[model samples]
Target: MENPKKDSKKINDLEQNYKNQENTTLTTNQGVKINDTNNSLKAGERGSTLLEDFLLREKITSFDHERIPERIVHARGSAAHGVFELYESIEQYSKAGIFTDVNRKTPVFVRFSTVAGSKGSTDLARDVRGFAVKFYTEEGTWDLVGNNMPIFFIQDAMKFPDLVHSVKPEPNKEIPQAASAHDTFYDFVSRTTETLHNQIWLMSDRAIPRSFRMMEGFGIHTFRLINDKGESHFVKFHWKPKLGVHSVTWDEAVKISGADSDFHRRDLWDAIEAGHYPEWELGIQIVPQEDEFKFDFDLLDPTKLIPEEMVPVKIIGKMTLNRNPENFFAETEQVAFLPGHIVPGIDFTNDPLLQGRLFSYRDTQLSRLGGPNFHQIPINRPIAPANNNQRDGMMQMDIVKGQTAYFPNSLGGGCPHLAKIAEGAFDSYEERIDAKKIRTRSESFNDHFSQPALFYRSLSQYEQEHVAEAYTFELGKCMHSEIQERMLWLIAQIDEDLANKVAKGLGLEVPKSIEQPINQAIGADADIQKQQPPKKKIYLDKAPTLSQANTKFDSIATRQVAVLVAKGFSMKNFKKMTDVLEQEGAVIKLIAPHGGKVICDENMEHKVDAAIMTTESVLFDALYIPGGKKAVESLKKESKFIKFINETFKHCKAIAVDNEGEDLINESFVKDYKDDKAVFINKTPEDFVKAMAKHRNWDRRTIVKNIPV
Candidate 1:
């Protein structure tokens, strides 16, 4: 209808505009072409990161300021007030009061979060979970900011911004929120081989944890523990949950997101409110400085993890989260954590990622919480007194009264003077250094394929199947065939069978070779051979601790059991099963056909927690349906009740039924699965409790995958 010439001209102008802005070469904000944006400048290949590294500063600074008012990563979070009690003093390794004082019950504030989501994103996203703990010690504040996974995607901190930008929603549309199953993410991951180790971990069940209380936490970076004699030992911190590491299937995770977006947040708060405090034992893998190079992997490589089989974890102390925050904003939202917040007995390592994080976290807080004075907030305040000469910032909550505000002042009588080493003054470890400054990672960090291979090999049979299925789902979501093919090749490098399975699921073939080399994460002028990962190696047959199959399953504390009932239910059967469950600390919720109370066969009124239509099977850990002829008939009328039973069986969760309750199960997909080990019919209450404690009958996964529910 309009002018054809004008339309052609507009198209021509748009093409010209795009051409004007096109530049294949990567550059800084200042328009300086970068030869190497992959590595931070360091003293040597394995030495500490240098302060003069402008490239690292610019990239990290930009990433830190990218989001304001909310954290750039770990935006959606929940917090709790806790106490860390020392089981025994390890003064031989460290002098920090929290670590050495057996009697001190150090107060702590812990925050759990999902990394790739906004402040409002769903809790069940398949992403890394942040497990950050801040300990208020007598000497100073110590923060162990870590994740549920032991390793990260990249090695050097210089590439962090690029990694985040790729995994985040594409800039053009921002369509996929809090998800990594996309074209940009695969493109980056295929090129950057270092991400494969953590990438495989994401595909595992660990990404979708059952609860914050049940997942293990890792410091991710190697840190140093300083003794009173100034001896240093490389240490990796671990938090072993009392409830054992467990995860929901990808199916259950998806359904839980829809049924209850705040599932995890509510689980944590409700557990604490009901006096079922969550607990974790602090463990550390300590390696002497003399034995730093004893392993095949570099201690400073953030992308690599030391296998538990190599260095055994020594359980040290226990932490119990007994209280929830009163105000989300005043406490959970305002609390700040910094890796630099260490006491006298703790010191930093030369790990490049850790070095960069020391600067990035503080910088992020400045933009997020207004200014440097965020530490003055009540939740983040230290148990030890803080006195300093620097003053006057935005939101300066402290009032410094003095005749002089400078250090070593005669007028103030040197009131806030520094203390000596013997008087608990913090000091950096005296690790000797003699090396030329360079921009490259250690050769030890180049073996990217071995650990990922080891991880895949360590998983149980069913766990491996889940990994393959997860990869299929994620890669299938990508629009580019080239990206999918590249990822398939990388997966082959990890495990050939895994790659083949995922490839089949995607209706594609694993490429024999690709146009570009396997690793393109190196610099433009860097030696390609040096950066490329070598053929996969077998370090050990398997690391048994890496798999959840070996985790503890001794108790059923805080397990949620959904009880399906209606009017004229058997009160005797209900009380018999619930009594033992409550004694074992399991939470019992009644789901009925309606919201109001239902009268049992004994004419006793029982409160209904929710109507059957309001809750899903994914919300609870297990199911119990007591026998009652009228009640069974009522439940059979509601179609969702059949779905509820079918979905529970599909998830492999434990299900128990009494006389007439068996009739209800016969009407659903669970009828065919009645003989399942976790499915108890007229079984003893103790036997049912034992089945529930096993978490799920994972063997049933082979049959349940075909369930329509």
Candidate 2:
């Protein structure tokens, strides 16, 4: 009768305490002790060192070969280890044990990466982000390797090499490190008609996500879901963030790259360390197999998307990342994810890109991991035991003891026979494929402009303007005039207004008309041609959800807020405001003239997180300049401090000032000091806290002028 659950919790807590205390460190590879590590062994203190210095030689040699070659794409990445818990069973949809068990929890590892960057590139690069999740289920490991955008730039895998070559740094000069705004990329865009939809997304806010946790992920290609009854349905996978989608402005993103190259990685690590686990809801869009051709676009086309309005995403499960990797190289770097590494109950569709990826991933891993035996690595090994007649290769970790290596041998007694269908053995979906051998896109895959136009027309006015601005900025960097003109003409085809707006920004004239051409293939199905253009379906009257502006903006959790203070700052008001905001899950940092402790009027000193010279306004979400007669007076004389406040205001972020601090704003010639929704003066800490939760003030952009270029 005496609460058994409480007793069990107490025992578990005691065990955890003992585990926490069992930690030790500091030893060389040979278990040798070195007292001084400040400097390596040298001759006569500052002279050239000798080879006899074993410790110095060992340390330097190890450091030299520390890094491995990064991925060809998705080179810049961040990762976390977590577990996925099923909320309910969907046994009718599939026979996979993980999906059919309501109370089961499966271990998972997720990696988020930028597509075009090198390992040392900036996190805020305007590139597609890879969202790859690997699940260790009871049957085998399943990898859902996807990207933040639901669609891709190419329809077939054959064009992948060309697409990557154009987007990467130019072969001759490698001038840009992690940028797509180049002549080669633009040239490819003009020729590849199927890339139109993804090009629009690239120009949208989706390209520059504020953080990995705030972005949505998609499987990109169509897949099949077969239930126990052998019934198949085409499906698309989605991972919607619980905190909602958010993005930084182009100017801010550019500044942030210089200010902090690891901005997104730092955000994710800090959130998990602070106990703010990022969450995402798993959703799927289902289309009956018989009705696959009912849609205007072909299901096999990777460049097209099935609008959510036509086939709504059904939310089924949730994945939460609550832990960070213990070692960057051992866990995050060595982890290999393949689209073909799927378990039972999950099968592939006949999408050409997916088919090519199935072959490319395993082949690439052989060279990248140094051999075919990469699965023997601890990070890549399956949790479910692997048993087969397959033998040794480079880096082989296992030894099979059997007289006969071949299957169906009498010496081995025909052992290791195939398991029954009831067992969790993988079998491809039994959909019939009776078509003649061909290597061309279906006729239904012809239309590439309708969805791009729909996406352009659905955005909010501010978002639409940003897209236009992004297109102008990217095209402006191109040195070739013809490339720019060709891209502008393509944009005109998608939406004439968008083309004109971008042209105006670039100081060029919009083309009066653009040419359209009929299909002429160079592959196996060269005779294929459409008699009519693909019809556009009316998905929504206005798809507000497609825009990042319509996402959630209520939470200020993990948001960095700058509190400007100096000597003789108010301790009472500072503590009061920070306490409430901190309780509401905001991160507060004090910025002063120097990084040392600042003395308050109440005789309390507080440590400054950063000094004015080292910290910029672009690094924070909002600014709060607290009140103190002396503190405000000191800040008013400092140009850097004044510019910091002005720039924050210019960025349309929330700004709060106390009475004494408000006086300094009025004296400064930033703008009219009229207190509005953005500029809060003489407000209570509660009121200021509420205002900061809105993320940013979109209305302020309309009034501000002479904004930073």
Candidate 3:
């Protein structure tokens, strides 16, 4: 058995350097022992947290500014401490130690976040999710700053600020936080043809994921992986979740925001704490540099994706996030991720959006983390010894031994010299760049509709319906008729049926002509007519990999199952179902009519995880009910219990009932869902487990559309 603690020496050493207060008296920041943290030094017994109270002042003052400036985007985040291990060495593709060393366990800190939301925003927002990972590798730190989607909204770095500003809340009112369903966003999207590919995806089920563990992540740019021989391959990195891609419906997302605003953050933390650590297979599409222009779309374009059918992803390793952050601020908040943090073999490309990020991320960290010494922060520090001539800045923790802060100093015996190339010295791939110093756009990046069309065509009918519904809901939120009209026209360019469906929902006609300068995202002198998007091509028909309908449904592991019971519930049915599910690594919680404990038919007491009124169906992945006349009748009294069962049915999640549990179902919407495949009545525990592994029954998707719960 491999002991994770023994293998992760980097984390162990890092922890040793931390000021752990375990089994110690509470002390002030200046190391003086404190007595009372409960009450302040008040003038009277009931006075305010006084300014004269040094102890109280220290605590309050620290807390007043406890929060650093939250990220402008991806402010709401959930992070985990993990380790990445290679399955096999791909030394030919890249010589980075984290990629090539199969024996080494590289400690990693991964933060998952929503792109549009503020720090206090809801996790269920209909926006892009940021997937940023920091690998504290032997060579140095490497940050893979990416998103859940493979493509982005813009092609150039210059338009990034404009894109973020438009998608954010309206500048005047600051209304509708963490959402893109506004006039300004559609205004930007309607004009920029490059935004179509990612805009369509945002309208798909990928935007609002069921859990952080159940989504795929993409590098979103054409990065380079160089070998020791200095050979470069255009690579697109992928993080394929083992639990498979899954999501809640838009209706569910809206309700879940109210039900549990910390849905994703809680799900991730609970899963890891329960020993069901989430895992992802790291894969890369290694496209030869010479074959970059072989595809119809430009490789340098951030708005385009190289279809898996064209260049198959090569699975390299697996990353398991086994631990939650020890402290949210020390680890999750302060940890910085930059695209510029690369090793010898991994390098950047000319992807404009990526080039912008390489600069933006580094600059943002300096502001957010106080100074350039942010790298010295424990969470952001590299495992390897950082010996350099770069001296003191803000928050410089290291104590320099000698009077040598400059390079080429003979007094300090010319110490801290640069490492040789063989000793893992950092080096960029020497690619020749001889071009005119002119501000001109590449005509190759103009064809944007084809990949979006390809993405839409690839999804299953059920998935397609979700996309259409998402578009209808988003566009319905916009107040401007002109914005909606132009959006409808853009939708028409992607698919006529999709456009017509949205038009019908909006109660408007798809315009014959809306705007002539559709591709107006160019310089002043550029010919408007000549800059028109080229005809979209049908390349490889359908990339099935893009569809979540084709995701793996192999395991029900770590799924949240809510068990409903009250006084005198069946002990037999509860034990039989839970024993199997618990064996399969599912976390089962007992929700009763009241808090505290519930008495089973066997007179045995079981702890109640949540009362009927306290919890909602949106918080759970599935529902289980055990038989007992008293238990069923008790659960029947609460209206929320009925709503709970109805909401679960409407969401198409698996529901299992044993013996008298059918009685409870009879009182709710489950009476109408008798024939539903996922609604197993008096089914065996094994059968319920199998159904849950399928995630949800899609056949029920059409029928349960109108259930008002």
* Top model number, TM-score: 1
TM-score, prediction 2: 0.87
Model 3 TM-score, all chains together: 0.89
Model 3: residues with Cα > 4 Å off, grouped in runs: 1-68, 518-521, 527-531
Q: What value of lDDT does candidate 2 attain over all alpha carbons? A: 0.78
In TM-score terms, candidate 1 sits at 0.96
Better of 2 and 3 by lDDT: 3
Report how far residue 272 has shifted in candidate 2, in Å.
1.4
Give the lDDT of residue 520 in candidate 2: 21
Candidate 2, 451-546: lDDT as tens digits: 888888889887888899899999988766656777887788778889898888887787664443334223323354433233445555666668
Selected candidate, larger TM-score, 1 vs 2:
1
Strongest candidate by lDDT:
1
lDDT of 1 by residue, 551-606 (tens): 98889999999999999999999999999999999999999999989899999998
Scored against the true structure, residue 105 in model 2 reaches a CA lDDT of 80
TM-score of each: 0.96, 0.87, 0.89
